[model samples]
Target: MLDLLVIVILLSLVVMTNRRLAYANETIHAKWLEQNLNRLLAYHTAFSFLFPLLPGDASGYWGFTLQQVTVHSNNMFDYFGLGTPFLLFLDFIPVKVMGLSFLTGNIMYGLLGFCGLRYLFLLYYKSLNLDILVFGVRTVPFLFYLPNLNFWTAGVGKDTLCFFGIACFVYGIQFYRRRIISMALAAALVYFIRPHVAFMMGASLAICVVFSGRMKAIYKILFLALVAAGAAVVYKQVLGYLRIEDLSTKSLSGVASDTAGLLEQGLTGSAVDIQSYPLPLKFFTYLFRPLFFDVHNVLTLVSSFENLAYLVILIKALPNLRRRDIGAMPMWMRTGLLIFLFAMVVFSSSLGNLGIIMRMKNMTMIYLLMYCTWSISRRKAELAARATLTHN
Candidate 1:
């Protein structure tokens, strides 16, 4: 009854917000943006309710375990890291303290993920001219409508929190000086949830800051010093959490070996045999596999369609990867690209299950999607500008 009541209230709020935005809109584009947001939020809420019935970790582990966890439980930290316990503790508040059902907890987390998605939407809407169409379609809106993005994020797990963290970090990167607290909070959220990803984000930020030609030399040095100091503070802890001996090439090779061994142990039907593939092949498979050739169920079929779109975007954006074109990209896009590449390389070497791959990649795929979309749009705008100059 309470869950239903809360859902009613949330839906009402969504309607109210949409009506307000629609009334303030003077053009069709603004109206469409509001409508898209309203639809996205509604889908997110619906998925939050539907995901708990699906046969996956959210339903199997998180839904059950978080409900069972109590404030007095000593086993919160029984896992290897603090990530699980932190999430458990978070869900415990609404579930155990305020006596909400696990379903309600899922809704709350879904709303949090919605906040992250909104931040991402605003980031792109502000940075890129989303009014520009690609292939006669508004591509930015389509990116948000991908089922996997909402499915993985609108649940009770690390994916939701990590997505939120990554979104906050990326959105804050646009105006880092003004949004330092947001970036810091995002880093901390990701550090507790997934330390290696936090490190990757920090590394990506450092690379972007160092190579950004627009920033002053003094600002570059200051940012580099800050990144170096942060890395120094967390390097050992992240390595320890990951159980990696060191950052040597040999140690990195062991990651692939370990992943191979894990895959060979009673793997399920959705496991991909990428253990024998080369590094480049592994990366490609991670980002663009489980296509039509690998579809086994309705879920995979839907995912294949989404992957097909990503492949199309990649092809469209390939020309923009040239040195000159890349150099023209904004710092945030470059940072996001680096982070996406770093994460893809690392996780592709480590994971073998298709289901897990889909969920894990959601954290970094948004960046790639945004970058590719923006590059394509920017190229179109440039071409239009050139044509105008030629005519004038």
Candidate 2:
């Protein structure tokens, strides 16, 4: 317990130190926005307490969730990846030592989230190794304080670890570029938590390698072949994790038919049958669904606003799209965007529920936003250059 408390205190201090640095580095509005985001994170943590207890709850209190975690920790490997069990034990420390409940644990997780995001920024800066900032000033804080990202990742669940894992993987990619040791660890961590997400990240990394331009053509082909082989090796395991049964027996049309049937069954009548839809519609549903028209509750309404923001961001990025040549863009930027689009297509095509899609896409949305921000920044620089030339 003392050790856990000490660790928590250390995390708090890290956040405090970084908080000062953020205020110094960011604009007043950005700092204010961050503070409000912190508050919203707290509010969301508090709000989660109101969620109804899971079934078979004997403990009229917070122990129900923890108890389940304890009971299921040992069997976690049988179902999810080893990551779930790992997080369960890690989360259990506070509860066992300090007698903390789910809500309190979530608060601590939120704090950890701040620390993780702070470290991610640090890693990003280190990778850039630049004195002069090249990206938009608002981009860093905006991604850090992204509402849904914080909301979902702040909880004491697999999502939190998954978020951390992605941050770790990205950090590893940025700093350790040639050495994938760190990235492998991050991937392994997330593989335990969510294998499908890990697979997507793996696919994205492969895409990055293809775009890197550092590798010879033969090596690129070889690398892609290896990635395909790896995917083949793990494909069945991923399908099993996804609970997609009998896929081997199904053709593409058969799979689509099954998906349509599942969507029709729906979750509280909230599912959409995207299997019958075209690619564009599927992408729209995945990226921009739960719009104002789809808002049936407070949560969806809040999400609708976020969706609207995505729409606005997409529109802003569209004009600058022509300015970007995929092959000419920096490897990391193009890779991140490709990963996001690939993941979006994968999710939007098969996913049935808006809420689930929103939550799941949290993994890739940061990369998507990063690409959009870069496009916007490039456009601004181009305009500035043009204005100077015009004056001359």
Candidate 3:
């Protein structure tokens, strides 16, 4: 436990030191020293390379740490290479070839984020101003604090990619309002990134088009259905083929994931013991638990703080709930919020415990951010429309 605490501290200090540097270098995320610099420049500082690569496994593979590649070193021979286990995918190359290690992987991961966020900002530019970019920037703070993000976003997971797809779908809808031809193509591109999500987005797009109330636009419903069905079919076929390939070729390939193996066993065993523990009965506790969250990497508990932030925003937003009528918000905003909320609730339903809420809270943070961003943007749009009408 002492060693764990020390590692966490090292992580905290590294983040503190590099926090400002990230803004300055714009790419401070790349662990320069870890890259095995063949030729150091006159202005290059050695700490640049070493600091981001320091050992910090509590962060899993993507945390600021050196020798971080070993976190998934076991998977070096998955051979199938169809898709990397979440963490292994990102760490696969950057950590080896370019030495992009911890911070750098995230910066690259953030590029996926940038794609999504940039799309949103461009679409909502009239409402989402420069201040909203700060919100986009803040996801970094949230990302750094999650031990899971190390692997989920940077190492090899699809969360960033998923968000990118969602953002593209939204942008496509807005574009379809004016440029119908491009809508099918934009929607199809997001689908290629993560077909499952793209299918869902396509469904939502269909619904939006159906109710858009423009008789001339009703034909879009068919286009959306064809697109949604096509994307889903492609995704299913690809995933199925990959799984079959894995069984035949990589059957013996996954044997190297020693750590993941142990973790899987421990999870299975503990799940059996869950009912025996007093945890399930401690239900109400986690709802407000983070205040004193200290034991398991307290720094990673930024998720709890994010939840708190959501609640505060909810409190401030209570006034809007007073009118208690559906017509209060714009049609697009209301419909989008409902679909986004549905996706979130469906996603969070899987996490079923308290003491272990640490992992689950990550999902909540993501959903809450999505919700808050939408809410703020919605209000801005409503205000702008009212102003335009008043002036006219």
Candidate 4:
């Protein structure tokens, strides 16, 4: 009964929010946005309700956490490295104390993930002209409908929270002066959930602030100082979480090799043997594998199609990927690109399982997609301007 009531409330909120956004933004197609939102809501709700019944981490996270909470165990800090216990404790509250069903708790977290996706949509909508079609379809809307983006994030686990945190960080970076609090909160959320990712975000922000010509020198200096101070406070703790003594190249390489070996050990069905592959191949497998050749199930088939679309976008944009074009991008976009590259470098070297790759890469795929789509649009506009000048 409570689940049904919450679903109704969620539907109501979605309709109200969709109407408000459509009314305010004349460029947005009301029907199209509403359809997308409704589909997204359905995907999230369904995945939340069904994932725990499957054989994987979803069941472990939900079942084990509930058991711990019900038994009044204080061992929540045992798996602090992956932030598993933290998420488990979060699951405990609504399920044990508030007496909500697992489905309800999952739906609630799914809603938070939904908010993150919405933030990502708005970021692209404002940053780029989404109406611009790529390959005969509007790319931004189409990208939102990708199944993996919705699936991995619409569950009760680290992926959902981390996705939300990254979304908040990227969106907030666009209007950092006004959205300072949001960015700060995003960093904190990710810090507690995935400190290494938060560290990468901070590093990216620092780089952007230093190189950005739009900000005044005073502001640049202020942010640099803040970044340095924050790094000082958290550097040791993050290293501890990562279980590394230092950030030396040798240490990082060893860590990546060890991680890849561990993940590849028992996961034969889904594992791709990339440990001995070259660096470029590792990155490619991380970002764009499970293509048609690797499809073994319905999920991988959908991901293959999505990845093919992304590949098309990349190929179309490559010729126009000039330094001048990149230089003209907004600070937030550049920061996102940096973060995406950092994550690819870090994870590609360490991940060996395609299933885990799909889930983990969800955090940064939006930035890559946005960058590609924006590049294509910008080049088209430039070509149009050139043609007009030639005509004159």
Candidate 5:
């Protein structure tokens, strides 16, 4: 009854805010995509929830230990220390309380993803001072309606958590300067959910602090030095938590090689020889593979088109990437883009599975999309200003 009452209230709010939602998209496709993605996630949850419930199930779905581990064991840190169990722990609640139905658990994830998306957009807009509602612009729709980002992230899994964590980190840094508690909370999310990403984000933040002209050199150096020391401590802690021994560079490469070998063998149909590629090539593949020619299915086909669209924007922006142009960019935007680029190179080198790649790309792609949007908006403002001056 309580759940039903909550749903009723949410529905009422949706109806009341229908006009505002319409303003979010000019066409119904983005709206429909959100609804459909939620339904798809629910259907997936319905099918997937059964695997763990069945006796002798050993498929290892979503990184959980089947029925043996309950939601109470989520933060047990010792038993389930590695891999992503936070999202599974979240799903466990609705399943335990509301009878494990798709409507209950998956709809909850759907709403979580939706909130994640909104938070992501807020991070971008606020960081760049972007106007999503520029009078005649249609480009904002792509940010909301990108199929792979929506479909993969709008589900009950680590992708949703990644989205939520990265968004929170960006928001905290961009908006709540000097607010250590908020930033720490956001960093904690990223650390627990994806520790390497937390490190990457921390690196970007430190770089931003060091290079920022607004602060005194001594202050910047002191802050950066403190941050670097903290990151080293956190890195050691993360290594200990994961129980991974051997901190040598050779061991790191071995791990990446072994992971690549498994991805090549395990992820049938999406396998590629990532082990053969150099680092730069791996980065390129990570950012822009599954190209139009590489499309083997409807999903990849759609992704190809999205890639093509973004590629055009990148091509146009490349020549304009002058030192002055970069200097003109907001500090947070510069930090976010560098973080995205660095994270992509890291993830791409380590991961070879196309499905995983598709899901993980959402973490960085939002920043790129926002950078493009901001660039376009800034150019238009410049043109409008010049026209006004000429007329005057």
Candidate 6:
């Protein structure tokens, strides 16, 4: 009886929010997609919240494990200790109490992505004079249809962590420029959730800031260094709990072995095997491949052109920059982009993880950077044309 009340309440809430939802080009959130993604998030969040923390050594035997960082001060978070890890807090929480697991994580992820989009649009608005707000407003359709984000972040997975990480990094750039304490705190939350991405994002922003010809290069390096230190601390704590012996040092090539084993089990189609692959890879393959997402090859390439979009837009906008007309750019806009670029260079490590999550590492910044730059440039053009018209 109570279940019915919950459903009715949820439905009414959705109806209320529906009118306010951004609907680019008149596309609506598909029902099947929403429910399926919600289920995935709920399952994981429930699991994360309830599961007890195992001793570091104990996690090594199975697919779920964390390396306890031996080199660390007394720390509050143990989630970093994991190598081939599991969700720390979110995984145990909702799963045990409500049998929720991945679904809750996914929901959080979606909200984070939405927040990221909003932040990026705001930055784009400040950077250039384009219709990015409109473009961003229209981006709703793409985000709604973005199944990978909808399903993964919408559930109890690292994708949402990634979403949060990327979004907060943008805020960090803002803080770095304004010298705000809240921005650093905001980034700390993301690193707490997903340490790997912390460095990746920090580096990228350093590059963006330095190259935009506005920020002091020294501050960019220092800012990135601080974030790196924070990430190392988080990694040390997490590994101290889980037991990651080495990253630059060699471990087993067990990555391929682990993946094969997962596939082997998945082939059985057990009741526990609700979906196909475990996360990291599951989300990537589904997003980039033809068999799953089912878009035309050209459209697929275009849609998947997350990071590459910047190269295209930069080519179109460099002439404008050369003319010394980079209007509305705060000194930090350049810093943010520089850091994002540098992260792609020095920190991203999914390449060696047997291609598991390799593709996702830097992709978050790609779309964010692309749309923001493109919109900013277009807005600048609008302002320029308007000024000329006024003079006439």
lDDT for 387 (candidate 3) = 93
- TM-score comparison, 1 vs 6, better candidate: 1
Error of 6 at 233 (Å): 4.8
RMSD of each: 3.8, 6.4, 12.1, 3.3, 6.5, 10.8
Give the range where candidate 4 is weakest over 10 consecutive residues by summed lDDT.
65-74
Ranking of all candidate structures by their TM-score, best first: 4, 1, 5, 2, 6, 3
Ranking by lDDT: 4, 1, 2, 5, 6, 3
Local error of candidate 1 at residue 133 (angstroms) = 5.1
**Backbone N/Cα/C clashes per model:** 0, 1, 10, 0, 0, 83
Off by over 4 Å in 6: 1-86, 101-105, 125-128, 132-152, 175-182, 192-194, 203-328, 331-336, 346-363, 366-368, 371-391
After superposition of all CA atoms, the RMSD between model 2 and the true structure is 6.4
Instruction: Choose 2 or 3, whichever is better by TM-score.
Output: 2
Best by TM-score: 4
| Number of the candidate with higher TM-score, 1 or 5 | 1
lDDT string for model 5 (18-99, tens) is 3344345336454653453344334433433332332221223233555534544534333333334544544444554444
Clashing residue pairs in candidate 3 (N, C-alpha, C atoms within 3 angstroms): 29-103, 29-104, 32-49, 33-49, 53-65, 53-66, 54-65, 54-66, 55-66, 90-155
TM-score of each: 0.85, 0.71, 0.50, 0.88, 0.74, 0.51
Error of 6 at 222 (Å): 9.7
lDDT of 4 by residue, 1-392 (tens): 76678767876887678667655553546676666766766766677776565445555566563333344454544434435566666665555455666677677777878878877776676666435666688876666767788777777777899989888888888777698998999898888887777877898889988888888999999899999899899889878866899865445545555655654555556787777889999988988878999988877888898888778878887886878876688887888888888888888877778877887788888788888888878878788888999999
Q: What TM-score would candidate 2 get against the native?
A: 0.71
For model 3 the local lDDT of residue 92 reads 53
Local distance difference test values of all predictions, in order: 0.75, 0.60, 0.41, 0.75, 0.59, 0.42
